[model samples]
Target: MPEPERKSKITASRKLLLKSLMLAKAKEEWDQEIVDKQAEKERYLSERVTPLHTSGLSLSQLQDLCRELHEKVEIVDEERYDIEAKCNHNTREERPVEVGDWRKNVEAMSGMEGRKKMFDAAKSPTGQ
Candidate 1:
């Protein structure tokens, strides 16, 4: 009887199959990571306090809290106004008078007449 044909060992096909399987496994892991991140986000949102959290407070308690918050806001506004006024006053007082003098000096040195006067002064003898 003739011997049965032996299967040829093809390393290239085996390597390709392995690479495909590894890529599939990596894709599955990436999908799971995305799912986990979405679930975590949902959990965080659910855990946050909403407006309904104050539902347990009585109407009188809520009213009193509101009144207290209004008082605090008014006090803060007054303090902020005072601070702004002081800052404005300090800024006005801190301005240097020399800035105006410097500007005048710069203007004197800029024009053609100023350059002619400068040349004349330079040409004059030091003894004069």
Candidate 2:
């Protein structure tokens, strides 16, 4: 009947209520998880039993085919490296740029007009 004891009883009741609410929420989440897992299992089983739209290859056969394809791709990559090595050995001569005439050549070329136009278009409409 004392004020401190009454406050302690109220606090204890509140703690019990909070604990029960948390447990209820956890139980709901657990139930939903179980339901989702069951649905996923059913879907997987259905897919396994049903004929696929593509080649009706079994899981094992598909795995073997994937392995074979991967091996073939690796062989192709090795051959490409060998071809690249030979090509690298046979180099073509490249013309060197004259530093003195570089500025003149760049000014004469119209290739930079597109870049200038794009830059001009990106300017603020208010001209800020």
Candidate 3:
């Protein structure tokens, strides 16, 4: 005879591949278990805390009531005025332009014209 054949006792690559396959199967089982638990939780919540069956009003009715309340709240007419002047200016100015009085303008805008118009004779500058 020429020679006798030899054989190895262990295979490291085969052992590593088996370990990885087992790990992948375990991860798949774990993912399925998590999905099952979430489904059970959803079912429990649907059965126990269903607001649609418990409340006398439906979802559309509740939405309509909310809209009506919002409309009612927006009905109030607000009178706003701006009397504050904000600026990043640091200067020495004499004074800002001032209208004499609002009461004078009202008297002028009324039917009482001619010499009786108090605001008609008054002259003021532009914005301050």
Candidate 4:
């Protein structure tokens, strides 16, 4: 009825409409983002995942397949363990011999007189 009151009511209605539109826009954007993410996930799965070839197999057949695979994996793991153990044993057995040979070679190269000089130099305080 008065001019100021009508203007105030129109402003309030305009503010409410703007708020509702903003909320609707935000919800639409959020829904679009979720759809985009789902599509991306589906694309990634289609590209990266290898489909199993057990389509026609029964449950018993699948169980047998799984058991055979498990047995093969176990056999391969045991063989790997045996190989590793053999390598460790060989390394342990050879290390001492290799060190002894290296020391002998060094001694042979330096000779007794050189060793004596080195020992005297180490014993001396200034170590010239």
Q: Residues 1-128, candidate 3: write the lDDT tens digits.
A: 87777666659898899899999999999999999999999999989764543278888988987887677556632211121222223223545668688887676667567344444455334322
**Residue-pair clashes per candidate, as listed?**
0, 0, 0, 0
Return the TM-score for candidate 1, rounded to 2 decimals.
0.35
Q: State the lDDT of candidate 2 residue by residue for 57-126, as single tens digits.
A: 8899889878977998899999999998877765443445455967765665546775676566678595
TM of each candidate vs. truth: 0.35, 0.32, 0.35, 0.39
Q: How many backbone clashes does candidate 4 have?
A: 0
- List the pairs of residues colliding in candidate 4: none
Total backbone clashes of model 2?
Answer: 0
What is the TM-score (0 to 1) of candidate 2? 0.32
Better of 1 and 2 by TM-score: 1
- Best candidate, TM-score: 4
Q: Which ten residues in a row have the lowest lDDT in candidate 4?
A: 1-10
In TM-score terms, candidate 4 sits at: 0.39
Residue-wise lDDT of candidate 4 within 7-124, one digit each (tens)?
4546877899999999999999999999999999999999977676899999999999899879988999999999999999999887764335678667765988878888888999
Model 4 Cα shift for residue 84 (angstroms): 31
Task: Write the candidate numbers in order of decreasing TM-score.
Answer: 4, 1, 3, 2
Q: Which residue pairs does candidate 1 place in steric collision?
A: none
